[model samples]
Every structure is written in C-alpha cells, then in structure tokens.
Target: MTDLPAATAASSRPDGRASPGLRARLPFLIPLVVLAVVAAYFYVGLGRDPHVVPSVLINQPVPELALAPILGRDRGLTTADLKGEVSLLNVFGSWCVACRVEHPLLMAVAGQDLVPIHGVNWREPTPQAGPAWLARLGDPYTLVGADPDSRAAIALGVSGAPETFVIDRAGVIRYKHTGPITADDWERTLWPIIQKLRAE
Candidate 1:
C-alpha cells in the first residue's frame, strides 16, 4: 500500500509528549483560577468579625412606617416619631433568644435615659406575645411598635432580630448594629455613637 503522510506531533497523542495549545488548556485553567480566587475571598471574609455586616441604610432617612403600638397604652410609632431627637430603634422578636440575651443591656440603657429607645416588634408569632415578652422582660422601649407582617422591618433593612439602628434628629439612620448588643458592645461601640449623635 502507498505510504500515507506521517502524522504530525499536533495530531499524535499516543506518545503523550506534545504540549497542548494555550487555547485548548485555557478553559480548564480558567475555572481553577476562578475557584482559587473565590476561595481566597471567602478565606479573607471568614477572618472578619461576623457580627459586623455593613448597612447600606446608614446616612439615609429612616424608612417610613406607621406601626401599631405593641402595648395597649403606648402610642403607635412612626418614622416621624424618630425625629426631633436622637433615638435607638431596636428590631426584636419574642422568639429571638438573642433578643432576650440583650434585654438586660437594653433595660440598663433605657434606665439611664440617655436616649429614646424605640422598638420594632418584628415577626412575632402573635401581637400579644410582643407585649407580654416586653412586660416580662421589663419593657425597655419608649415606644414599642408591632411589625407583624415584617413590612416595617423590611423597609428598615432588618436582617434579623436584635439588630439596632441609631437615628438622628432628622430621622436619618446614623448607624446599624447587626447582632445582639452586649454590655461591652454598648459601652464600646453603641454608647459612643449614641453620645455623638445626641450631641449633633
């Protein structure tokens, strides 16, 4: 039989000596590089304090919400209620264990009367439960508002229970605390911010 042309190295694979073109290998390398970048991003993120989630609502006006009073005797709370003075707007739920954990600190702060402490009773199983919980825990809120459907919570960009926002005299959100505010956090972080906002 007539000899066919010798197969070039580019077409030969059995010897496993030929290098693959950059284009042929790029697809495989790209995913590995992307995965490595993502892993490094998560590694850096994991080292960060999990409690500190940045809030986009900072320096913006508080969300407008006209919420019913959680307790019968208290007036309903609104965004307008947050105006005229610096206040702490706390988002809590009767079912939140962390909220209960932070209750004493809130009570202590409220007792000091350093600033008005408002409440958004977010996603409580029942409206009545919010009042009872507050009553049992010694209601720390100056005005407690029920957010049964979480509409107000959503508007305020609440991620979960026990978050707190510092609102300025103009009803702007000055800062946000993402987790349970412990006595240490209150003294170290929240109290200082509250003091500064009050002065302004």
Candidate 2:
C-alpha cells in the first residue's frame, strides 16, 4: 500500500487567509516615509520668508539702461536718470497682479513727492497694455520704460515683477525690495533707508 502522505502543515491562519509577510507590509511603509519627507519639508520652509531672496546686484552700480519709454510716453529710462537723488526703480508689468496691488501705495508716495519713482514695464504682450494699465492706475513713475525683452530686468537681477530698488544719488543700488511693497514696508523699512541715503 502506498504510504499515506503526512498531513501538510497549514501555512495560512485558521481563518483560511495567508499571513502577511514583510513584502506585504512594505507598501504601507512607503507612504508613511513619503508623508514624513513632505512634512519635514514644510516644517523647514515655514521658518523662512519667501520674499527675502538673495541677489548678486545688491550694492552694485546701476546696470546700463537704454530702454525705450512705454507706449504713449516720451522719455525712456537711462542710467543717467537714476543719478543725483534717492529714487525707486520699480520693475513692474501690467499683467502682474502684485504690481497693481502696490500701485496705490506708489501713487501715495508719488503724491507725497518724497522720491523720484521710475518704472520698468516688463514683458507686456502688447505695448498698449502697459500704457492702458498705467492710465487706469494713474502713473506714479517719473520715468517709465519698456522692458519687453527683459534685458534690463535680467541685468538688474529681477526675479519677478514689482521689484523695487532703492538707489542712492550716485546711481548705486542701495537696497532691493522683492515683491509688492505694503504700507508697512514703505513706512517702517524703505522710507527709513531712503532717508538715510538722502542724508548721505
């Protein structure tokens, strides 16, 4: 008689389901690792200000500017234009919402006659857009130029629209303010810097 096969041991649980092994558990661990990485990334990022970016152009002489005036305007902006006073060189664009947000404050600054504000209208799809937006917002710039190709903007180390530089009387860039200038930024920080520069 053939020997009866010894009863095989059950690999599965009494419930008839296979026991989960390391391979089965690995997939669950992957998401926890990913989540941990993401959470740590945000935790580090939360401590830094997004607007305080580094620039190679800070404290450097103003780059050469031969940009033409925006549409419907006569004088263009030149490096010569930035000399002989404390001024704001604001790089902006009509399409940039942040520029619009900062315009009223600029208008107020212009209204006060505190400093000469110059503008670089950056990368407009149509030349008319800059002129039109300025007309609606009311031009605060003493001199406004078109930077359709971003030559001047790149030289100025511009990362985005609505970047304002505080230039000293000698055509030197003293301070660079990235992003829109709020009332507090103007009053508490920039205005004081300008006052100090003006005294010098």
> Would you list the C-alpha lDDT of every candidate in the order shown?
0.86, 0.91
Superposed Cα deviation of residue 195, candidate 2 (Å)? 0.2
User: What is the C-alpha lDDT profile of model 1 across 64-155, one tens digit per residue?
Assistant: 88998875656888889999999999999989999999999889888988788999988888768888887777988898888899899889
Q: Across residues 97-188, which tens digit of lDDT does each residue of candidate 2 receive?
A: 99999999999999999999999999999989999998987999999889999999999989888899999999999999999999999999
Screening candidate 1 with a backbone cut-off below 3 angstroms (N, C-alpha, C), the clashing residue pairs are none
TM-score of each model, in listed order = 0.77, 0.77
- Model 2: residue 86 alpha-carbon error in angstroms: 0.7
Off by over 4 Å in 2: 1-44
List candidate 1 segments past 4 Å from native.
Answer: 1-42, 49-52
